[model samples]
Target: MANNNSTDKQGGIKNNNLNKTEEEDEKKKNKKIFIVIGVAVGVVIIIIILILLLFTFCRRGSAGETEATGVEMTEVMEGSEETETLEDTSGASGETSSETEESTEETTAEETTGEEETTETEETTADEEAIAPTITLATYMGPVYSSADGVCYYRVQANVTGTPAPTIVWSRNDGSGLGPNRAQVNLHSPSETYTLTATATNSAGSDTESITLSWGCNRPPTVHEITLMGDHIAGVDYTVSAYATDPDGDTLTYQWSASGGSIANPNINPK
Candidate 1:
């Protein structure tokens, strides 16, 4: 019995030692769980601080860029307004200069027109200052008679008068005249009449007068003699001679007949 009580006390002591070891293991596990929780909390706090700093920096940079852009826009708008004002001033000055030039040209045109009208009036007045004359008679100077040989001699004259003392021109069908005054003529056949015309003229007009003169004759021309140039050779060369006359200075003709050797240039003066 005493040996059994001693074994029971020894078992009681082993149970107390196992109970102490279990209590120590439970305490160590609780401490490890607390350390893990603490480490997780510290890492979360550091990540929150870095995110807040990044957000603040980005907001400040955006604000600075917005201010610089607004200043550039204001400068560009001011330059544009100044350029528009200069252009408006130049346009107004150019219009004023153009209007002045047009007014000067119009005055010059009016002066030129007045001068041309005055010149036309002067020319019309000058045209009214000239005049002409009239011719009254164109006749012979005297009452003429033919001589015994059927010839007559006379002088022709014209009478013309006007304002400005116009000049006279005389023309005859039978003879030539000198100047515009008179003509002297010797009539070969008194039966042949003459027509005399006189004209008077000046700057404004002209006039003409005419007359006819006639006579009677009863004689003809006669052939008298014709003289040759030199002597005659048989078959080489030769000349002839004769004499002819007319009382009224009329023309005459001569005819010849040949019955012997050949005559060269028979119709000529020397044959």
Candidate 2:
């Protein structure tokens, strides 16, 4: 009986150790399952995050394409409006567009081009209008003529054209005229050179020309008989000398000159 009781105690102790080891093994299996589940959850969350980022990128790309297309459409629309120039349908005239009426670059570029052009034209016209009316001098010739006998006097002749018939200004350095073109002077004085300068003037401008008359000479003087020094004596200066009669032929004298230059013999005929 004593042996049987000892054997029974040993068997009980072995059974307790086996049970403890089984419990420990079960706990390890449960912990491995929990770890695997946690790893899977983490992987799934990472995939979801990646998917969300991809979706956001796609939305941004689509938005960019829409914006770019919109801008291009707007530019095309604006360009068409700027380039389209339809003809006007107004009635009442039989006039057509002129070939020379070319549209300027500004016309196509700006909306207010017509007004700007009109303003410019008006200003230009105003500027040109400020200048006064000009007169063309048609005839500025002649030292024209005047002579004194009983009631006659030294005169000048010229044909001038201006707004108003030019007023005559006469200068007589030769005491041959009484009060100038309208006066008479004694041609019987000591030989003297007479100059007749005339200025033709109008309200706008004035011009001058001169001629000389010699008095107290031996014979009838050809007042302005220009002599030739060369072959073509068109506009050349020359020494002048001529004859003048004292009308009564009572011992006459002579004086000759150019504008102011004197002649050699004032009382005799030239050789």
Candidate 3:
């Protein structure tokens, strides 16, 4: 019986040792699982903190850019207002200068117009004064021979001056009619004497001038011969000539009378 009790006690001790070894292995496994969970949680917390810092940095940058843009806009607005104010002031000054220039030009134009009117009035007043007419007679020969009518004539002319234009009238002492400002007398004999008078009349005054004229003797012209040339047929042309001379060295004129046909160039000496 003693030997059997001792074997039983040894068996109990071996079982107790095996149970403690198993319990220690279980505790080791639990500790390994807790360490793995703690490491995973720490990695997740670090990732979340990095994301918050990035978001804060981005917000600060955006705010700074917005403030800089606002400042630039304010500066641009101030510059625009200054430019507009300066332009308005310059425009007002220019208007004032233009008004002054216009006033000066108008005053000068009025003064010039007044001077021209004064000059015209003075000239008109000077023209209103009156002066009497003065008469002057032109010198002429006593007798002159007319070749066209074969007659002798005495002629005189007068010149007159006055403020207004004068009308001249001529008269002869022998009760003969006369031309304007001139007297022409036809002579039938060489012993004739004539008194010529010129009278100038105007609105201002009147004047008279007188002259005396006498005629000298002139000799008559004598014809030497007359000749006719060319065919005397009715439809043909013929030329006629007259040979004549004067004793007093006067120019002689010829006249032709035709009973039939025609005469060409009647005023010429050769016909």
Candidate 4:
């Protein structure tokens, strides 16, 4: 590359002092510019190498400086282009090998700093994932009723489900744990039997479901109809039976009473 040019060439456009055509001059200028850039890259590489070498050999400091100066000269080869783009133009005077060491140190420092920044970025991303939406229980508990006092309250559990579960809120007008599931409906008032409902939620979403219960408590028996065994004999003893029902099956007992009515035969009364 250095051989391509002659000292007598005007403006250093080509090998000879002979005047070239306008096209030829333009092409030559472009070629030189490219060559200058390549040389600049090489100088930069040399600076890096010199810096590494200097770390071990003190004498190489001057060698590194010289390489760096060459890089500066190559850069100046394109100096008239722009000033800001030519930041390291100082390389011309920094020809001492010491400049090479500085270049390498700068690269090392940039690498270290970049690595730490990358690590911090990864940690921050992980933290964001850790704090992802959480499912919270907005409200959860069983509802109670007067009959439920002695029996298990058919608590229709309520909850919220979404990213970040909401807080659970509940109230029982009966001052009992027996409240409607979130809807504030009074259960067990009209419906002798009711199904409990519940909701699950998170900050992002919510879902609901029914809660099951097995109520086995006895309820006051309701008398529906009465039946007699059979037509009774004038003086015979017979049994009169009663039919009753309760939500829960409970054994029933019987007692006989009379009002104005008496035993069919007072004289035949056994007890």
> What TM-score goes with each of the models?
0.35, 0.32, 0.32, 0.27
Local lDDT at 165 for model 3: 76
Better of 3 and 4 by lDDT: 3
Q: Considering every candidate listed, which one attains the maximal TM-score?
A: 1
**lDDT-better candidate, 1 vs 4:** 1
Alpha carbon lDDT of each predicted model: 0.70, 0.56, 0.78, 0.55
Point out where model 4 deviates above 4 Å: 1-98, 125-226, 229-240, 245-271
> Can you write out model 2's per-residue Cα lDDT over 49-89, one digit (the tens) per residue?
99999999999999999999999999999877666522232
lDDT by residue (tens digit), candidate 1, 1-271? 9999999999999999999999999999889999998888888888888899998999999989998898888888998988987787687988867887898899899989999989988877655665567777644554354556345555667676666667877675334645566654456665566766778887668898876656534355565666556656666655666676766566655456568766565555422
Residues 41-158 of candidate 4 have per-residue lDDT tens digits of: 9999999999988786876777899999999998887675666445555556466457778999999999999999999999887655442333222224344334544443432445
Q: Which ten residues in a row have the lowest lDDT in candidate 3?
A: 172-181
**lDDT digits (tens) for residues 1-271 of candidate 3:** 9999999999999999999999999999999999999999999999999999999999999999999999999999999999998888687988868888999999999999999999999887765776678998864644666666655677677877897878887775222455466657665555666677788888777999987766554857888888888767878888788888886689777777788887786677753
Candidate 2 displacement at residue 27 in angstroms: 0.6
Clashing pairs in 1: 224-243, 224-244, 225-242, 225-243, 225-244, 226-241, 226-242, 226-243
Q: What number of clashing residue pairs does each candidate have, in the order they appear?
A: 8, 13, 0, 46
Q: Which 10-residue span in candidate 1 carries the lowest summed lDDT?
A: 138-147
